[model samples]
Target: MQKREALEFDILFVGAGPANLASAIHLQRLLKRHNATAANPLEPSIAVIEKGRYAGAHLLSGALLDPRALDEFFPDYRAKGCPVEATVSKESIWFLQSKRKFAVPFIPEPFSNKNSLIVSLSRLGAWMAEQAENEGVQLFDNTAASAPFMENGKLTGIITDDKGIGKDGNSKTNFEPGLLLKAKAIVIGEGSDGSLTRQLSMHFPSISAAQRYETGVKETWEIPEERITAGEVHHTFGFPLESDVYGGGWLYAFSPTLVSVGCISSVGHDSPVCDPHLNLQRFKLHPLIANILKSGKMVESGARTITSGGLDAMPPLCGPGYLLTGESAGMVNMQRHKGIHLAMKSGTIAAETLFEALLHNDFSTGRLKSSEERFRNSWAWEELHAARNYRKAFDKGLYSGLVQAGLQLGIPGLSLKTTQLTLPGFTETPSFNPKKKKIALPVIPEFRADGMRTFSKERSLFSSGVMHEENQPCHLVIKREDIAEICLKKCKKEFANPCQHFCPAGVYEITTEPVPALKLNPSNCLHCKTCEIADPYGIITWTTPEGGGGPGYKLS
Candidate 1:
């Protein structure tokens, strides 16, 4: 590859989500504070890179905002326009069966959210971007940081993905190589399952400890005015998932007629039939949920993978010239199903540490290591430490997890006694063997999209506004030609090509017209990365797509 265009900054933050946005805002203030006395044009420069076509196009979350970090970030933020759609006023928990539901008499203390507000995280990211720009941070949308640029066994900066290419591995008419963005200090806040984050963590042996993941699918509905009580919050467990599977479902009435229904299926499932997409379809047909969604019109839907492991298994925060924050560093509090606040807090700490390093003319691990210690002392750290064993406790079964979690709630010290389950999600299931296992399902896993209430995968993908250039090379790579043959054999025998069942968007299919093979529809990709994590044969690798190609998620 020939040399490409390059840009330099004093500090560069990747991803335009909450964490990087918060860091850029804080760093702007620090830079301005330092240059208050003398007007130096050579002072620190801050920039943020985002893959979205716009500020909010690639962000998603169930998204109830805890105002702790926001309160600290901007005390007078209320004066500015806020994106909170509804303040959570009513909350409840329930256990549901196929035909009935029963509310838990008492809601757990940790699950309480009296002051939180329901929000579209994408909207929040746009608002934060506005705040960052006001503080003089440069924002670059339609640009994606693909991989870390390493030199001399240390980090230097990042390389953006190439702009144009074709399926034949040759440049197109609009061919353009990736650009190099250099910075003295870098911060990666690119949500869970990010491409660059994966490279940084996986390639580096000392930094790659966190590996647990969960697939989350969500849909927005426009119901009748009388159907929903605004600001209502509800969470569920037990019915949709088996006793051995670690997962749950959620519903929240964020507006007068808009409700979000979703399901989360953890990756360390014991059944070969642990299909998350089909599981959510079954969950919606349940009487309890079906009643709420009756006569409702589907608005939008999307899916994303979550990083569930916290402090105990998280990747290292600092290496040489860069610091990792947000879900990329495993900052989520799995017990509460919350992470935006913790991610923002990590950004604040990263900002403080980087500013100090820049001021002192040092970017080595020796100086950047302080950021990790600073995070360890923050409230976000305290919360994660207390709930560190929450997700891992479920490895044995739901009962063991529930018991351990219940005990830790009343007595925080019990967390020390909680055992850590370090099982990697990819190694949990077995490959297809017709004689040994039987596939279980609610509906045929191969249901076609109807574009109506019972929408098919392709129609559901349309709801997400997903797009990719037809001429671009396939992003989902299969290691060998025989792998498709194996999947085809399993499809014929028993498994029915599990990728079609697992992908929230219909990206994979088995074809027999020309020849029996596993076909890929990359244009329908939701960018969820579930196929990369859950493939039984361990052959798929999802590389970065074109610079500006993906679902344009506005309200996810």
Candidate 2:
């Protein structure tokens, strides 16, 4: 085992996203206020660790709408001069099916707006990071926090995966167990549930794994002169050919020649069965969408997970010496596809609560519980509550299907508001069964294609550039008959196969024949691991590939 020097700080924040950055800023301001009168004030020492090499590099490649809540966090955000493209000139929602469409004009409600500004998120994330640094927050990039450092039932800091040798041939560096950094408290803002957060949450039984999630696949396109333009954003329901699917698609214009389009779907739902990439391709081929992309060319495509667990799905916000914020605690509002704002607000609250607790030198759950109360009182909670209600109706397919049908009816005064009365409450009823049932698996055909000679053999297909290593062969002992039985059992228990719906690269196939069997198209696999999460059965296991193999993106 390798030993490394230990570092310490007053507070340690995980993740460098908007929420973490906002918290850093707010904490600085609070400390400054409290220490103004002290003869020898103790300044709060803070550190933020980011897995990515650059702040906001992961988010900047995409486009986002700037919410009004941004003003509450950064009053001079606009003046700071980030890469804001355009203020929304027009906003309209469409209930769409095939060639028919209905336009619904919704009035702005608190925390909800149709006319928000379009921004370059990559730039925005970097900007927030800079602001945090300017306020005396230390940042550690290219370093991942692997686990929380716990001592005597309190979170002190975190362990990191930071190991590299110097450029000189003789210089050598070895992997070291992360050093413990003692702090008064810690804040976990890790984006989504994974190995570390899962371990931490398990240690505290108050957190639940029932928090919901949805998969989002997005593609950016660069087209000709007449393709897409600024100020035009399109939302479509009842997508072409796949009218039975409950998910919706979007087309947002960034530059005159660049358009961002994608779809978001629930993880485990049947019907409207189609691959996300194929859906994007089909969406582009739609007469309405095609007309805009007539001369356009595909630029890039990516996928990410969205948390939809709502208020009921929230994890315990505070423990002995830690607070969970952002998506890590399930603060996303799926109804509006808004999470960034909520993440920022939650982080701010956590920081404020921590600052107060520090003043009294009380970091117990009693003092830190204020974070949860603040979250409930904020707009984030209200938005999540509404989204939870909307999802209840959405689950029955009544909300989206009826809205689409209503739009197609073309009644002059018809509007989504008119159907609001039909929306179901969160506690309405159980539309799905909790118990698993036995079902026959569909049979899939074998395609004997050379893996190396596959069409998608291009260098860009597999490398994420973030973490790329050579693939290694694995030798495992599992009976073939047992594997078959497990696969069949998984098909019955896990509703809505993830391989069929969420694969952005079209790697997995779900056959509708004799028995459902998953076919893997290794060549098209982007190594995104969505299939791994979507797999109710632990069938999809990943192994490191040959060095330097995988998709390499300009921006992810």
Candidate 3:
């Protein structure tokens, strides 16, 4: 069965990140301001596809940039060469403690950033894919998307992965076949947990709620220009996470010798060994982050998964023909740990609802669901419904989630009743029951990777330049083909396997001398779907891996 090759488009856009490159440069500036006063002149064709081998190769972030949706659709985005890197000036907040740190005097207007810029969201998505290819938009970088081309029951575009398969799965005389892109409108912005947005959420299901996630784990240091300063921002939250474990840690600078650090757990944190990269190596051995990385070096590393369920865990922002902007549509807010300007304001409101469905040709789901009622009437929906209970108010722990974030920042109408206090990041993990009493796990304080201040995970997957071809087809699947007796007798008797501590690029090993199985080092993937979102028993999935392969993040 090798006879594919179709390629139309009126609009395609599937993850070139930064919300489909700000909806393909704001739908090419709203079709050049409505074809400069239409006299029946509505041009359509626009594309954007990227499965990253470029366009910020699997982009990662700690990226602070709230440039208000890039000053509302590239208002000369710093004169169009926009890759800011430093502007913040100074901001602070802290609380850590495994050695001491307290700071937090003010700076909590949703963790203020002052001027906000410190970026590298993979170099601001390779400079927003060069302003979405200078606004004409058809960009394709290593392309991926592998499915959701549906026909009668809607969608209509995207099918791209196949290419030279082989590790015994055959078809390898440089086999190609995998292109049936067609499109009348497709948009997806695949990011958090997105494998074609989880196979189109089983035919557009998602009546909101039930989407929670958080995994972060970044790095990118250099430090030592007199110990940091360019835009110096910081943010911390209690010590190595166990007040029932939600998490946080950051550092931003990007200049006083290039900073940007990380940690951000809570993928439903109960514990299947809660390791967000060993809680980012116990948040860099916090003596206030080891004296700001004592001498600093680690140039880059990555991990991701954070569509932190705000606005009640979003999902169906238009169906039928499709449209779900950034972070595949949760459009993160998490009380302002921020989502690249709410994913570039949901890519400029999915480019103003696909420019009125391309001036009335109507790409259906009720005319693209009025781009979700114009994103719930903008201001990125009042900053994600005023931080809608910020990540489920830390699932009721960390000091009752900092007293429900200090009463939703001193009662901003109680964050509109917190979307009924949501849940679902795999119900915060721990459940194989064994008589219900398990959790006590938090002791994780060991450290000694020291290839110059903590390194291993195979040297942070070789500084996260993660490569893979090893004769194709093994995009980390394991949907329980008895994954070695389910990782040796029920994940080693209830969670001891924890995918070798939630895989921040070590790619799950478990090999007891070729007897206990589950080896899979899928080219040490850093495409961070965090073992398919903290795999409890639901076997791991994370597809799409042969499109210029994962991680080459140039500074995450």
Candidate 4:
């Protein structure tokens, strides 16, 4: 490894997405206020690192519907150059059965607007990054942060793969070699279920792995002239065989020529059913969806891992010298399939909390925990809480059946009211149960030499005949006895089987076949690990390898 000079900063922000950018802006504003009033103006140096080549190039969204969080964070966002492609003119939910379609209107409380605006997240991210840079925040793209740097049980900075460096040592001094970033504090906005955040949570047992993830596979298409206009968004609950899965699909037409379509599934580590992409393809073939896309052409396709582990699944938001925000801390409203807004709100609150901590010269867990409280008090938390129980209802086959039923009645009011009324109560009592019967499988080492060697040499592996890339080598090893002990001691098979239905990659295979086995094709694995948490058996564990070994997407 090449040695290089270390850099110092007061705050090192990991990730350049909406969350990080929002925090950067808020921090600068707070500093300005502090400097204006205090005797000594504290100018805390801050830097933001983004793995993507550009700030928002990798940020994904399905035509963000009117984000109330945006209004709360930046009341003047529209006036301040936020781009709005088209205002949503029509919002309807559909329940489809083969060739028939049922449509109903949905109204989430307080968002009385039947028409919400559609936003281009790429443009939005760029704008936010620009604002951060103008406020003096250093931004570095294509810089991948792999782990948090720690000293005496406190976070200081991060270890990153310096992408700017060249082999011949002729690159810019700032990008010349491997270096440590020592900082007074670090804010992680590394997206839903980021590896470093997971590691940090592990270091602090108060945070549970259960508060983890969901997977989203989305594609953008160019709509034909005969189809719907820009400013229309559609959601569907009952597809051809709705009885089989717990997830649904969505279509958002941002422009007459552009539409975003996608699906989200619940998956666990031990599941052996459903591929997200395959589901999406099946969704497209649905009668209603087929007609919409009949004239449209596929433009972009990608996938995202989301944090849907809910309030109970949340990780510790703060620790000594470090703070976790956005998806890293499980701050997503899965019911709405929206996270960007929550991420931004959480980032803003985290920045404020940290700013206050700086004034007190305290960055300990006790002090940083204020961020978590702030988040809990915010509307984001309330919305997530409200939708929390709905996941079970969704799994109970309520979404597809009820949604379809409401549509058939042609009573949008009934459909909307039913969802609104039942959502909160359902969350109060999650009806989904796990399957109790246990199927014995032969004990196997968690880490197999054969699997490692195959993954290391080929860079691509197949399990159940699906191809996926293993960008990183495996670093976790477990004895077969350990697996047996975990199964015998800690396993509890639940009926909902979150992992089986949730994975976008369809990596887990859950069946009662003798020796319930999960065949991992690392290539198809998005590394979301919803399965790991769903595994009551504690059969799954994740480890880091040479950095930059996960999926590389053009627009994920």
Full-model lDDT for every candidate: 0.79, 0.60, 0.79, 0.62
Off by over 4 Å in 4: 1-5, 36-38, 105-115, 162-177, 399-556
Once model 1 is optimally superposed onto the true structure by TM-score, how far is the C-alpha of residue 458 displaced, in angstroms? 1.4
Q: What tens-digit string does per-residue lDDT give for candidate 4 at 1-556? A: 4565679988889888788898988889889888998998888888998766567655666656446767766677788887777887877777777678887656554323354667766667888999899889999876667666777877887777643333343454544344577788888887765667756765676644455445566777776775887788787766633464556788877778778787765544443333555456666777767777775666556566666656556667787888877877777765566777778888899889979878888777788889878877888787767655444344446555455433433432223334422221112111223454554532212222222111111222121122222333332323457444433333323323334444445454445467654334444554445444444444455543333334433322
Residue 462's C-alpha lDDT in candidate 3?
82
Q: 42, model 3: CA deviation in Å?
A: 1.7
- Model 1 alpha-carbon miss at residue 214, Å: 0.6
My TM-score estimates for the predictions, one after another, are 0.93, 0.77, 0.35, 0.74
Query: Candidate 2 regions off by >4 Å?
Result: 1-4, 60-63, 105-112, 162-182, 240-244, 269-274, 398-467, 471-501, 505-529, 538-556
Q: After superposition, how far is residue 104 of candidate 3 from its true place, in Å?
A: 30
lDDT of 2 by residue, 109-220 (tens): 4224356666655567788888889889998766566567777877777777534322231223453344555677788886755434655765676765465555666666
lDDT of each residue in 81-116, candidate 3, tens digit only: 787878988788888888888887877677687777
Candidate 2 lowest-lDDT run of ten: 451-460
Quick one: best TM-score, which candidate?
A: 1
Worst 10 residues of 4 by lDDT: 452-461
